[model samples]
Target chain A: MLLDKFQSMAGVRAELEAIGIVPFGAVTEKITSATEGVVNGHQVILAGTNNYLGMSFDTRCIASAQAAAETWGTGTTGSRMANGTFAEHIALEQELAQFYGVDQAIVFTTGYAATQGMCATLAGPGDVILLDADSHASIYAGAQLSGAEIIRFKHSDTNDLEKRLRRLGDRTGNTLIVVEGIYSMLGDVAPLKEIAELKRRYGGYLLVDEAHSMGVLGEHGRGAAEAAGVEDDVDFIAGTFSKSLGATGGFCVSRHALLEAIRFSVRSYIFTASATPGVIASVRTALKIITAEPQRRERLWENAQLLYTGLKQLGLAVGPSVSPVVAVTIEDRVEALQSWQKLLEAGVYVNLVVPPASPSEKSMLRCSVSAAHSPEQIDHIIAAFAAVNAARPVGIPVA
Target chain B: MPNYNIYVDYIYTVLRTIKQDVEFTENTDLVTELGLSSLQVMELIEHIEDHFDISISLNILPDINTVGDLARKLQELNG
Candidate 1:
């Protein structure tokens, strides 16, 4: 019975193999640039990776990582609560707090941990968590682990959320409302202004996960809350250094004084080894770069618009807006799989989302634009989609 | 507290709106018999919550099996 799940998984894998493609995990042989890579031996434009600012290959970040590795050795080898709390770890936390203009911040091993830890630790038994149905897996995992009563509101629907809040009534005071700045699958922005208004009328703490939106939205790139001008109303912000920061770590910044106390209670922070000295160094440098460079965000948006418009002009079904994440919806799974493979062959790489992973029954080819993507690269990516569409088997409806 | 039978009848009525073709009864398994996906199950919970003016924690889902079980849980919560 324990192995039955694996058997079911094997059946799924067999079906995928029969189709000659398993889009879930394709190996990248080499990363030639921030926007290009050799994937499965085919040279392709990297349109799926969430390297928004493309700080991964920055000379300053690389130099800092190298210097940190040389000075502090490699890994921290212990959890932050134990022997892992280095001076640099504390400094990075302080820097993140400053970046968000918050009084407290805590760092985690990965973005998943940061979001999950906050979700799990922020509320416990007898408390309630109201989250978007389309929230990331980390949020779900954390909510389930928290021993809290969990409720899912319809995705980005302020009316649905308000109705739930009304139903909560007195219990609304103990509820934690969780939403993402930019949804990962379809790249839709949350209606934070309306949600903040609801929170003001109906009492609840708000936590915005800005993993994808950090350094990609707002004048200073704080996230959707800042862009929406409800920063004061937002209780907490959870984000990742892995996206725009181009390093491997996550953080939670809050103006609440309880955040420092929460640091000791989060199992994810206390149980896992701290980030490597090299990663911390690179992330610190990347944070500075994000604050200094507004051009990167502009370039990223330009590339996003170019890809989104080009795809739309090709008569493809794209997301509602021109977010850095452009998802092409295809109703038929077989056609989606075939199109994904064709795009790869045409020297473009994008994510293939289907089934439960997708928000709905439709499969999507999710493309994420990066600041490092040149206009030519964006055009080529769009061209690959066009070619794939043109070559679709006759009688298959255009997505 | 409301009569337990009233809860059962109301649940069957709600279930029909979601799956009009399915034959329903108190003993019909909500998951296996109706073949409700996770999303559908959540929808069912939301609808029931709205109609009854109650908050149903997803944590209680594991213990609920048949239509009757859900009604019983509703009674317990409201009681």
Candidate 2:
């Protein structure tokens, strides 16, 4: 009976496979390099990976990760509060705080846990959480666990957010407004400037999850909050190392000195094993490289512009604006699936996203551009889209 | 007394934002006819609750199917 809820999913899977679209988890056979990979025995250009800065293959990062594994064993057998916190972990936290110019930084095993822990630890039952309707699953999960009254405003509609805040009346001061810097699915940056202004007027804590925008925005690559000159207004920032940092971990940094108290209170942080030595070392090295090599960010933007312009020229529908991620939106699921399969067959790979998970219930082929993508590869990806568009014209009406 | 026309107009306004050039009748199905997903419905509810100064429980959600159902329920709750 427990598995009965998921029984209908098998039918959905068969329908997707019937149209040659692989749902959920599709495996890449091998990764030959940072930007190139062999998927399903075919050498495919990776356009869907979130390796924005492309530091995964950097020599310093790789060497540091390898050395860390050798110095310390492969895994931390316990949680950070227990037997897991290493000097590298503490050092990385310190460096992150310095990078963000925040007072405290707490690292989590994964980005999801960081948000989950922050929401659960910070907001309680009587408090409120006003979030964007298109927020990522992790934020929603955290809000659910927070025991707080959850409210959602129209996506990117700051006016609607202000309406909700005004309606909160006396509860406005105790509310937490959650938004993402760059929404993972649509790749649109939040209107942080206006939202920060709202926070000032309404009196509430602002949390921005820069999971996709960190290392891709701002003069110093702080995030959208920094880019919009609202870094001081943002009360907390949660971000992931899996993206631009090219490793796997999450962090929450804040200006509030009391933020360090979360380490002892967050069950997600206290219970889960800390990130391995290798990931910590690699992320630390990547963070240093992010600050040192500003050109990587520039190159990433250039690549993003190239792909975005090319896709648009090919008459494909893309997300709001050009950033590291470019999502080609398709309203119909079957058409999206067919297009995804067609792109893969042409030696190109991108994420095939579907309803409920994707914002606004539309399907999308999400592609994230990397700084390391060569001009030829960018051209190749555009050409692949052109070919697929010419062959299958995704705008075909449903029968 | 609450103005019924105002509540109807408010519901219509929310539906129009989701889709313009569409008309909302009292018996119009929000989901099937208007093509609103569950998330959009929740957004509609939030808009109503905020402007009406009322809290709608999830228990009443199952009873709401059409625009009239929602409007009538809001009136009942307000009373």
Candidate 3:
């Protein structure tokens, strides 16, 4: 009886399978290269992963991770506040802080934990959180955990944000406004300049989640805040090592002298074990590569443009902006699945996204580009999409 | 910007921008009739906020069903 709520999920699963869209449990047989993988007996080009810099296969990163695994062993048995605080963990935190030119930084087990813990720890009860309507799920979870008075403003509408802030009157100072550097779904950049200006006028703290922006924006790869020339204006920045850094971890950096105070209050951080030594070591190496080789970022954008313009030329609808994330949208779920399966058959692999996960219930065949992808690989991806679009099932139109 | 008629015309224009094939009327349901996604509906709300200089709560989205409902809300906020 306690598990009866799962029936609704079962009904939804049945409906999706009947429509030929299975949105879960995809297993890749082997990763032969940075850009290609074997899935279901087919060698497919990997375009769905968030490995933006393609450093996952970098020899230096792998070498460092292998060395760390030998040196530090496998897992840390304790959390950061307890026995889990290793020297390398503290060193990585210091390195991230220095990279962002912030006074302090705290690394978490995952990016989701960093965002959720920071938001939950920073503000609570009487405090208000005026967040972008299109914010990621982690941010919303953070606000809920914080017990803050949550209010969502129109996405990217500075004027509306100001109006909501103004309505708070004396409570504005305690407000924490949260926004992302780049939205994960549509790959759109936030108006950090305008939002920063509004925070100035309203006297509220600003939190920018750079999960998808780090190593892809600004001269130093600091993310949208730096790209908008408002890095100094942002109060807190939460980011991840999984995307461009090609490792797995999350961190929050702040210029605030009191940022270390959150370490004691964050339940997620207090309860969870620290990242593995191998991951921390690999991420440190990846950070060095990100700084040393800006060409990877440039090539990433070129590939994005190549795929974006190619899909547009083929008359397929894509996301609003051009970034590493290129989402090809279809009208409904059935069409989305059919196109995705067709792309797989043509030796391409992309993410099949549907409602609840996708904004506005829009179904998307999401492709994430990487510097590791060759020009021919990019062409193959475009050609695969074209083939699927040309042979699309009858009566199902592109939205 | 000057009157309710202008607001109505402006809202109609924004609706058309979301979907070119749709015909706008007071009775047109935003979801079923216009086929606007939740994200597109948010876009519509943003355009409305920009034009009227008002902040509409996201919670009001479910209460609104048709073009006339949106118009009435806009008028209420304007007053």
Candidate 4:
């Protein structure tokens, strides 16, 4: 009798799950031999994960994780500030600072925590926090929590940003500019140099979240800020170890020592339990491998360029994406879901981004490529898309 | 930009950003005509807030439906 809200949720859940785009709790590793799933009793290629560098199964990282887990047991069991602080965490922070060529680096339990914590701590009641309209939800939540007058500029529109900044005038005292290094859905990168210059002029702190671009972009795998040659121009560079590094954790690095002040102020860091030793060990190994293995970055770019070129040659709309994450836009949500189901059925898995996730009218198929995928596997994926996309929708296809 | 309806253009951009229909008229309801969910409509408010640099009251937004309605409100706020 009192199940109306739950019933509505159940309906939405049923619709989503029926289409193969299983939400969190319902995710069936239908192909579990490799990453845990039981899909028709056989292992399936996992292409949807944000595993850009494919370092998850690397020998060194695995070995390091094993060692740390064995040595430190299971969990940290406390926050970083109190009983949770470990030598490994400090070492990782130092390594991340050196890696980013920044003077300061503060680690957090998650990339989301890093973004939210830093933004929330830095911005104040009267301050303006302007961000790209397409920024991640974490950034939005952080802005909300910061009590800052949040502003949104058109995605990647420098002139629009200038207009917003101009309006703020001398009130720019505590203005904080935030943008993502690589957008999650579209995979398009931000114009960091243009934005950094704007920040420089406006006299505000600039923060770049490299959650999607951590090891995917930049020659040194530093991120968009480094790639855009604005590493120095940017005031803060926050990143996740989840993507290219193939681990779980986040860090915020900066040229100014003031960013360290946020450690005492940010609640997300002080409240949550610290990251496990295993993640730190593996992330360190992965970061080293990321910097040393230029070949991985090259191969990743090769795979991305191949897929993008191949998709474009097929005469389908593939991106606004300039990175390894390629998105094919579909105007209809049902059509998008159908395409995703077909891809899963064919053993080529990708992320299904509908309505709320997409910052545009079209739902998107977000395919993330990695260095681990061979030329043949890459070709097979493209061929599959070609066949699948061509067969469906005689009048209109998802792409 | 010539002969273009700036109001409709702006509305289309905002609606498309939130994955709603681009169709709108003077009497169309912002929530009903476009079928905007509560979340998306809030996002629309955020878009308007940034574009205009003026915070809108919750009550004033509920009566808005079409691009004309929103544009007129924006003009009033600016004035």
Candidate 5:
């Protein structure tokens, strides 16, 4: 059955490769120089990554990781549901809870696991999971596993949302409306306060995932919910340290005591080992930097604005992004592939997205600006996009 | 109870923001008049679920041809 499934999807890998995405995590994984990624021995800029904060190389984080690795050895060797809870793990969870200003926090080995696990635990059968159509695959997977009837809301349209709710009546009691603080693809934000207002009036919980927005948005880096002034109104906050934190783990923090119960019941939580010592240490250090050094976030935004304004000025179809994630939406898939190659040839690397990752028949050349980037680097990024824009009048549609 | 009034209000907001022009009471084809692609229609339904705090099945999604048709469907769900 496994081989049959493989055979059925045999075209997927080759198909993706033909489009330039290639077996991304699989390829280019060979040991290369740290400062630049070598793809076929060509040094390429990594604009596709969600590393908005660039704390992956923070010396203090590295030191903390090394220190934790030396102290705790390697892996936890057990799940948090069992003997996996080390003092460091407990301390990290406590610190994260305090950081988010929530009563309890549970750490998962990956952000994907956290989103799926917490969604599954929080929503149930006969309940509703209203999601954004543009939500990440992790959110969709969580909603699917949660046994709730999945409902999709138009991306950022609060009015279409109210109509869908009126259609549900008393069933609203069991609903969990899911949204993200900053959407990974187009880098757009949800209308959180309005969503929260509906959730409050209609009797449901709001679960906001700040996976991409953590350390990148809001005053204290609390994310889009804080930006919208709906922090306390959100029932659960889910995020991962992978993107901005440059670590590998996920977390769910909530004011509900019920969240603590999910720790015992969720299989994904029960069976999986907790985050490694190094990861926890790095995240702890990363969180401190995210809060203490607001300059990183500011610089990241400045870079984003530079790139965005530059591309627009030079006549490119850049997205209406409010964050560091700027998307260049193209209409045709093959054309997107060609544009990706062009940008690469121009010395910048970006994410090449096609449907169903892209919405509304849209393909995107996704570029993420980072705090690690220099202004010259930002200008180079702009120049690269400008070159691509000038060279091609592609078949991208205006919606 | 002005349930139709609520439907018109919702439609007004959607049209103003997403579409731009539409008559409330006449035959208003959801896809054509609202200019909603299939993907956007799906998103619209999801937004309705969140807005009303209720669950709607993708299966029950109506071929919304007129403003009255959408209003009637909303009444059925609200019932």
Candidate 6:
């Protein structure tokens, strides 16, 4: 009975095995570049990875990481509260705050921890949290942990959100309204402009998780909040180094001075070991690159446009907008699974997202474009999808 | 405090909007009997919160199972 929950998972694994496909944990034999990798013996274009700026293989980042490894050794080996608070860690925190134009920033071991820690510590019992229904798992975990009265408004529906906020009435001041800059699954942006207006009318602190939008949106790549000209209205900004910075770490930055006091209260920040010197170094280098080169962001958007048009022209149901994350919805799970395998065999790798993981009931072949992907590579990715569509049964719908 | 029967009747009204055919009572299991998805459950909670004008802590969700259980919780909160 203790392991009964795993029975269903085991059954699902067995079903996939019978089909001779390992969709979830397909191993990458080697990464050739930010855009290409050898996956399951197939040389495939890496479309699923969230390496938006493609800093993963940047020579400057690599060199910086190497230098840091040489100077500070490999890892910090302890939590920041204990012995892991290295100079580079503090520097990264300072640089992150400066980048976001905030007074303070607290770095965490991972993006999940950063968002979750903030959500958990910012509000507690007797307080209310109004979050988007399609918020990331970290937000949900943190909200539940906070023991607050959690209310989920329909995803990106300002009317629904306003209705809930109105219901809160005098308790609006005690509410923390949480939303994401760009939703990961569908790549649709939050209506921050409208949400900020609502917050002004009602009263609540706003937190935006810019995990998918940090390096993908805005003039200076500050994310959706900046693009919408609502940076001042935003109370806290949580982001991850894993996506755009091309490293593994998370941070929460805020103009509010209370963030400093809240820093010591976050258990995740205190319990988890600090990021390695190498990760910190690479992220620092990546941040500088992001600031200096606006061309990367432009090229990324261009690639996204190309892919979006290509997929749309092929009659595939793509995401709501032309975003770095382009998801093709497939209502049939079997077709989605088979199409994913077919794409991999054709030298294109993407993420196969199903229910629960996907925001909706539909299965999605999620592809994330990086600035490093050449135009030719984008065409090839489109070609692979076209090929799969052509091979589908006559009665079945094309994904 | 609101009468527990009033809470139950109001819950039934909300549940019918989600599923018209299913018969619900105070003792009926909200999850197993009605087969309400997580999203549906949240929708039900939102409706209840709107009607009552009271914020319900999610920490109490695990302890709530039947219509009666929810009604009792609502009554306690209203009290």
Stretches off by above 4 angstroms in model 5 are: A1-9, A12-26, A29-35, A393-399, B1-55, B58-79
lDDT of 6 by residue, A351-371 (tens): 999877887667999999999
- Candidate rank order under TM-score: 1, 6, 2, 4, 3, 5
Cα miss at B8, model 2 (Å)?
9.3
Minimal lDDT window, size 10, model 6 chain A: A390-399
Relative to the true structure, candidate 5 reaches a TM of 0.82
Ranking by lDDT: 6, 1, 2, 3, 4, 5
* Alpha-carbon runs more than 4 Å astray in model 4: A1-7, A16-42, A393-399, B1-29, B32-34, B37-79
Worst 10 residues of 1 chain A by lDDT: A390-399
**Candidate 2's residue-wise lDDT over A1-399, tens digit each?**
788978779889887778666746878889877799887656899999899999888999999999999999899999998899999999999999999997799999999999888887788788988888888888888888888878778799998888888878889888999999999987899999999999999899999999999999999999999999999999999999999999999999999988988678998899899999999999999999999999999999999999999988877788879978898888788778887888888889899888778875678989999999998999999998888777863442221
DockQ of each: 0.60, 0.20, 0.19, 0.14, 0.28, 0.39
- Using DockQ as the measure, the top candidate is 1
A1-399 per-residue lDDT for model 1 (tens digits): 778869977988899889778687899999988888898778999999999999989999999999999999999999998999999999999999998898899999999999999999999998999999999999999999999999888899998899889988899889999999999999999999999999999999999999999999999999899999999999999999888899888999999999999999999999999999999999999999989999999999999999999988888888999999999999998888888889999999999998778888689999999999999999999888878887766622456
Q: Flag clash pairs in model 2.
A: none
The TM-score values for the models, in the order shown, are 0.96, 0.90, 0.85, 0.86, 0.82, 0.94
Query: Per-residue lDDT for B2-70 in model 2, tens only?
Result: 666677889998888888998779899988788888878887887787677665543467688898888
Chain B TM, every candidate: 0.91, 0.89, 0.86, 0.69, 0.70, 0.93
A363: Cα error in model 2, Å = 1.0
Pairs that clash in candidate 3: none
Candidate 2 ranges beyond 4 A from true positions: A393-399, B1-36, B46-79
Count of clashes in candidate 5:
18
Candidate 6's residue-wise lDDT over B1-79, tens digit each?
5678888989999999999988887899988899887777877887887787665666678989999999998888776
Put down candidate 5 lDDT per residue, B1-79, tens digits, no spaces: 3376676677656655556564544466777666676666665554555556655654345446665676677777676
Q: lDDT per residue, candidate 4, A1-399, as tens digits?
A: 777659977888888777556633425445332222444332456666778888888989989999999998778999998888888999999999999887789999999999998998888787878888888989988988888777777789998788778877897767898999999887888998888888888888889999998888788988898899988888888888888888888889988988778788889999999999999999999999999988998988898898888877777678865578888888888887777777667767778887677887678877888888888777877877787778865723634
lDDT of 3: 0.86
| Overall lDDT per candidate, in order of appearance | 0.91, 0.88, 0.86, 0.79, 0.78, 0.92
